[model samples]
Structure formats: structure tokens, C-alpha cells
Target: MKINDILTLYDKILIGFVIILSLILLLIPFYYFGSPAEGEELILKVQQGDELIKTVAVADSYDEPIVFEVEGPIGIHTIEVNQGRVRVQEAPADDPLKICEKTGWVDREGPIIVCVPNSLSLWLESTNSDIDGMSW
Candidate 1:
């Protein structure tokens, strides 16, 4: 007859399970995708071909974003750093695919962005790898 009278025990259990599952799904991404802890810092190395050209440091938090330009084999590439994430802000208009510019902000290592046409690339390094022969 009424809402409470019509509902059964299984329906309430299913609703509670769904709510808990939804909460977990919402939080897991922040755990896995978040940048390193505050003050840890991120090191960015911008290279042209095999030669290293610029080294930039990104703080976990900053007042203003840092921008720089690198002269690659073809032309200049603009790099920007905000907070702890770095990205290829601009590449030469003639770039083949603009892959680097589309890479967006990267806060973690291992996902290096490269522009083959310009022979320019940038890589982020983690400060956690301080292993020595003894620790290994």
C-alpha cells in the first residue's frame, strides 16, 4: 500500500550497496591520479633530440605559472608549468600532429611528450627513486 510497506529488505540492501560502491568509484581516481605530496617538487627536462636544452622545476603550489621557450631544430616551442603539472603549451604551427600540445598537463613521470617534427620532447622525473646498490 504505502512506500515502506511495498519495499522489501533486499531493495534497501541494494540501495545501500549502490551508494557505497558509487562513493568508492568517485574517490579511487583521486587516489591514483593525484600528484605527489606537497613540497616534493617535479623536475622537467626538455630535450631537443639527444641534447638536453632546459631543466625546469615545478613546485607543488605556486603563485603564478611558469612559461619558457625552447629553440628546437625547426622552431620555438612554448612550455608552461602550473602547480606541479607541465605541458607543451605551444608548438610550431607546422608540427605534424600537435601530439605534444594535446598531451595536456602531466604531473607524473613515464608519460613523456614528444614532437617528432620539431625534435623536441619533455620528460618528468620522480624524486622517489633514490635507490643505491645497497638498497637494491
Candidate 2:
């Protein structure tokens, strides 16, 4: 075919592809991410050497959990806050895995506390906190 005819055919194909792609894109948000809804609260507590540190209210914005690192007389610690519960866990002694420890506490709408070294964790998903998101 002539170059002009070829160009016209290409343009028609491109237009058809764009229309199909646009329809597919419109359906993605509803199926993949869904509607944007308010995140639930996640409360967490860390205890070390007789002192307890509670995390401030963590707002829901990101899908990933909020990570909090604590250092005290007991040693280094990591906390993960998601939904409305806190996951408090002990840091590894040797070749520690801070990220893995943080991932250990993953709850959709509850607390999944884990203290690896101390073998202590308070997981209360149904329980309500004093300040909705405050861990005490």
C-alpha cells in the first residue's frame, strides 16, 4: 500500500487501541484499589526497664503500617502500627532483622504484638483503647 494509506490505517488502529485501553483503565480503580475509605486505628505499646512507651495516634493514609523504633535500657526495639492495634516486638540480638520483626505485627484491624526475644506480646484486636488509638 501507499505510505499515505498505511498512515491512515495506523491511525485507525491507534484510535481503536486507545478506546479499549481507556475502558480497561476505568475499571482498574474499582477492582484493584477500590474506593478510598478512612483507615482504622492501631494502638501499640513498648515496655522496657519498667517504663512503657505508647505510640501516638496513627492516622490511616498509607496501606503499609507505621513503623516506630524504640531504644532504651532493655535494648533496641521495633513497633508496627496498623489498623487499630500495635505490634510490639524485641529486636534481634545478632544479625537482627528489624524489617522482619516489623512485618511480624501485621493486623488488618487489630493488634498483633510480638516480642521475639522477651517472648511477650499483647495482641488485642477487639479491645478498645483509652484514646481510640492510644496504647497504654
Worst 10 residues of 1 by lDDT: 127-136
Clashes of each: 0, 5
What residue pairs clash in candidate 1, if any at all?
A: none
lDDT of 1: 0.79
Q: Could you give candidate 1's per-residue lDDT for residues 1-136 as a string of tens digits?
A: 7988988999999999999999999999578545565545568888887899888776633778999898766778899988878898998877778889998988876578888888887977766644222210
Best by TM-score: 1
Global lDDT scores for all candidate models = 0.79, 0.51
In model 2, the worst 10-residue window by lDDT is 123-132
TM-score of 1: 0.66
